[model samples]
Each structure stands twice: as C-alpha cells, then as structure tokens.
Target: MTLTRRTLLLGLGAVTLSACADTAPVSSLATTGLPADLRPTPNAAYDAWVASFRSRAEGQGISQSTLNAAFRGTGYLPGVVRRDRNQTEFTRTLEDYLAITASDERISKGRAAFDRHRSTLNAVEARYGVPANIVTAIWGLESFYGERRGDVPVISATSTLAFDGRRGAFFERQLVEALRILQSGDVTPANMTGSWAGAMGHTQFIPTSYQTFAVDFTGDGRRDIWSDDPSDSLASTAAYLSRNGWQSGQSWGREAEDGALQPQPGGPRFAVTRNFRVIKTYNNSDSYAIGVGHLADRIAGGGPLRGSFPPDQFGLTKDDRIELQRRLTARGFDTGGADGVIGNNTRAAITAYQTNEGLAATGDPSPELLRRLGG
Candidate 1:
C-alpha cells in the first residue's frame, strides 16, 4: 500500500517520521473533554471502541471533560477503510507526471501564492534556511495552496481506522493525539478534520506529525493550520523542511539536458543533494520530489525544460510527437493537432500506418518509426 504522508511533513501513511528525529511529547492533555472518566470500550461496536478508548484516555491522564467532547457524536466511517485500502502505484512518465502536478495552471497559481506571501515566505526562509520556492512547491502539491485540504473529521476518521484494527495500533495512537489536540484547545473537534488517514491542515500533516512539527508561527499560541489565514500552516511547512535538513542552497535535481531523453524512467536525475534527499523524506519517491522541484522552478519563472523527455515506452521528444502527428495527418490519418501530447488518436494512426507497411502494429511510437514516416 502506498504510504499517505502529510505533505507538511512526509506522508508516512501512518509511517512515523521525526523532522527533529523525535515526535515531541504532549505534556498536558488539553482541558477540554468530559469532566470525569467514561466507561469501557464499547462491545465489538465502533461506539464501544470509542468508549473504551475514552477510558484509556482518562488513564493516559486526559480528563473526563476532554474525552466527553472529543468522542461525542463520533463514529466509524467505512469510506476511510476504502481509501486506506486503495493506493495507485506510479506508472506515468516524468513528462506526464509534471503535466499533471506542475501543470501550467498550478505553476501560475504557485507563483501567485509565492508572490502573495512574499514577506512571510522570506521570513520563513531567513529563519529556517529552506528556500521559499521549495516550501511553496510543497504547498501547491499538498493542498493546492489550501484549496482542498481533505474534509474528513479527524476524530471520526482516526477512531474508525483504529477500531477497524487493520493498522489498529497506529490509528489508535493518532486517535489519542487527535484528542490531545482538542484538549489543548488548538482547535475544536469540528475543525480537527483531515485526509482519511488523518493527514491534516494546509500541508496534510497527520496527527502525530502535527505534534512533532507544527508550530504557532502566527504567535497566536495555537499552530492553526486549518484557519483561513494560513500563516501557521505556511510557516509550519517551512519548519518541517528545515528540520529535515533542507540544505540552504540545494536544488532538487533536474531533467537531464544531455540529449538522451529516455522518458520512461525519466531522462536522468542529478545525483541528488542532501536537500534533495530530504525532499524524499517527505514523499520518498524520486518522481514526486522531481515534480516538486520542477514545479517550484516553473513557479519562479524558470524556463521550460531544456530537454524534451527521451524516448518513453513510445520513443522520443515533443518535436518527434508533433512531427509524427504532422506526417500521419499528411497521409490521410487524423492524428489530431500536432500537439506534442500523444493520446489515442496518434496511437491509432501509428497502428494503421504500421499495418499498411507490413510491420508489426504494436501502435507504440518510436524514433525509428518516425524516421520511416519521414518525420
């Protein structure tokens, strides 16, 4: 299963990561829930589990008052189970990946977010030693600049996952942390919402991650990642990166400018610096970090990639795609506009041409095929 890391911190998918090498311990349970202890874990029922958990919380030094409010009206959500079970593996080419993650629209939006919060970002940079653009790139990827932080109630989701017992131990801990967050009064249970796996806030930090890395950057005493202001979330994200050892002047590799654009696994990766490695700590996927880096570069007005990706499973470059499209169009095949993005129409045209040429009609594009087409 793919790990669901909170983007503000590396989505560990319940995987534990300490930006500071250790999650900070909550010293006092917030003074919010029930005044006295609640009864046992509910019998085989999700409600029962929560009840038992409330008692457990009381044992953990949480007050009855905190448990009462935190668990009230909370119940299991089956959708969280479904989401937890599903994880799509990486299959897209780097070009295709960038096309989606760092699309023109996202780049434009990221640039504006960078511009809109220039002073805050600058302060974060000065203090944390992480580049402002890198942090902003992560923001764009995680919640689309806070446009879509998941809407699931964190308590309900964590309790459900905990009760479900698949990753029971992990979820149970998160459930406790969610309660602590409430007890501390950083936010109400209503506002303690996040992804099904419980990654919350602007940067998708899971509950444990929040305790570990979240900071009250607004100086409001609460690290408010969910509020509309986003000062805390933005600052908190920077703090996470900084703690992960983000080198002050490092670049997260780049598209290989070296002519051979083998697109399948992506052209070539620069041997990745310490900062680049730290980016991996967040998502642990090369493509993911690459996407963040490229997108950040684009948002900063950096030029389009100098090298078009090399031959994918289908062979070679933007020019090749357009030329192939043009050639096929000339030969009575409608390959659509010479747009470098080769979707089905282009594939079908190639298949048809191959069949007429007495060749194997695999339908995949190749440089050799382009040469034969005089493209």
Candidate 2:
C-alpha cells in the first residue's frame, strides 16, 4: 500500500490507502468509471455499524445535519472491503518503479501539464518555497496530473472502510475527519469524491493531511482540491513540502556516479539531498522520492539517468527485454506496446507464443526464449 500524504505527516507507517459519497438521491454517485464492486451493495452488518457509528461521529462534533446528508444513499462498498483485505507488502525495484512512474507518457504529460499551468505552479512556488517542477512531478504521480482524481464519494468510501474494520480505528478517524470537512462546508458530501481509501484531490491528500495542508489558493474561500482547476490542489502539495522543511532552489538529489545509496543492487545509485528526504515525508519510499526527482528533472527538460541498471534475474537486459517484446508483438502476440516492462500482458504474450510453439509456458523471459522468438 502506498502511503498518503496524511500518513507521512502523521508519522504513521506506510500503506496504500486511496478515496468518497452522499445523498439527496446522493447526487447520483459517479458509477460510470467505478468498478462494479465499488458500487453500493447491501450489507446488514454494515448498516447496523453505520447506525451505531452515527452517535460516535456526533460525539466527535459531527452535526446531525451533516450525518443525515452524508449517509444519504451511502452503503457498503464490497470493493473497498476487498481492497482493504487484499493489500500486499510488495516492493518494486527502483528501475521498474521509475519505468512506471516516470514513463515516457507520464513525462510527456507532466511537461504539458506544467506548461499549461505554469503561472499557477509558479505562484505556488512563490508562496510555498518549493520548486514548481517538484510539485508538478508529485501531481503527475499522485493523480496523473488530475486525469484520475478519483470519483468515488468520500463519505461512502470512508464509512465503508471504517465499518469493514480491518483498520477500523484508523478508518473511523478518517471518517470522522471527512464528516468534519463536510460539516465545515469545504465540500458537499455529494461532491466529496476520491480514491476508494479516501485519498482525495489532485495530489491524493488524505482527510487529515487536507485539514493540515490544504489552502484556498484561488481565495474563493474553499480549498477545492477536487476542482478541475487544480490550483488549490497544486498549492496544497507545495504547502505540504514547505511546511515539512523543503529547501527551495535545492535539487531533490541526483544519480551520483559514486553514490552509496543503491536501493536495488546493481541498479543506478542516487546521492539524495535534504530535499530528497523532504520528498519522502510525502511518501516514504526511496523509489517514490527518486521517481519524483527524476521525473521532475525530465519535465524540466533534463535527460534520463546517466547510470544503467544491471540485468534481471533472467539474465535479460532492458534491451533484451525490449527486443523480446518487439519480436513477440511483430509475430502477432501483442506485448502491450513494447515498453520493456514485463507486465501481465507481456507475460501473457510470452505464454501464448510458447504454447503455440509447443514449448513450456513459463511466461518468464530468457535469452534462450528471445533467440527462439527470432530476436
């Protein structure tokens, strides 16, 4: 699970927690792109839990009116429960992590997003003392530059997870904070949508983080992170880093030729600076921080890392992997655009090709397999 800004600020351990609800016909929840499992599903136990929770929420100073409005049409989201139960402690190599987070497409989009909102980003930097490119990189990673600010209703998602009770106490606190946000009129329950775990807005600030760092950059009296305008969200992100001691005009760090820190053996080593640690205060992962730094560099017209990563366990270099993917795709086995990342599609393509050729379908790439595929 990836840590939300709230978790980092609160000094809690890292875990992926991500998105929202309400009623008056519940303002018609955005179910169009949401997974079916994320939709409301009847659960007697969950209803009873919410019923009991209303009093605790009230005790926490949540108003009756807010509760009434928030719970309107909200119910158990089975998918939220499933997501809670299914979180695995997995780690990705720095190389692979950058491949996904700072990919060509993400870099391209980040540059365009930065350009499109240059004035706003610069204004945020002026106010917060964090660089524009670093903030933009964060926005790109957190929500694909606002392209995927989640659409699940916040009340519903938080309440459901709170009731699910794996991390019941934690989620209950989040639910309370969400209710408080609604009570304060920051946003309507109907419009308080976010990721399933309730990470909201463009930079995926959890409720507590939002309370601490969100700002009404547009001065419209609302810290509208969810708005399409993105000014508040971007500013809020800069505020987070600035409040946490980001050093303006300092590099997050660079890939050093003699750097001692190498997260993955035989991969490019990085000599991170104080600002790199500051970035980790947003998401406590070396890969995440490095991804932000490297992606920021790329968005600012910098080049790729100077060092190269070593081969994979299969003895295949990135070039070897790319050739494998290209060969497979050329033979009509689509490896999902040949990015050299052996994701499920690429593995499936390898399996299909092997099966068709009466070879074992290991789905693992190898020099032998690459040669067999006419690489």
List candidate 1 stretches off by more than 4 Å.
1-44, 254-268, 314-375
TM-score on alpha carbons, each prediction? 0.74, 0.93
Q: Each prediction's Cα RMSD?
A: 9.7, 3.7
- Candidate 2, residue 163: how far the Cα is off, in Å: 0.8
User: What are the lDDT scores of the predictions, listed in order?
Assistant: 0.70, 0.81
Task: Give the lowest summed-lDDT range of ten residues in model 1.
Answer: 14-23
Q: Which has the greatest lDDT?
A: 2
Candidate 2 lDDT, 261-367, residue by residue in tens: 89889888889899999998888888889999999999999999888899988998888888999999999999998667888899999999999999999999999
**In terms of TM-score, how similar is model 1 to the real structure?**
0.74
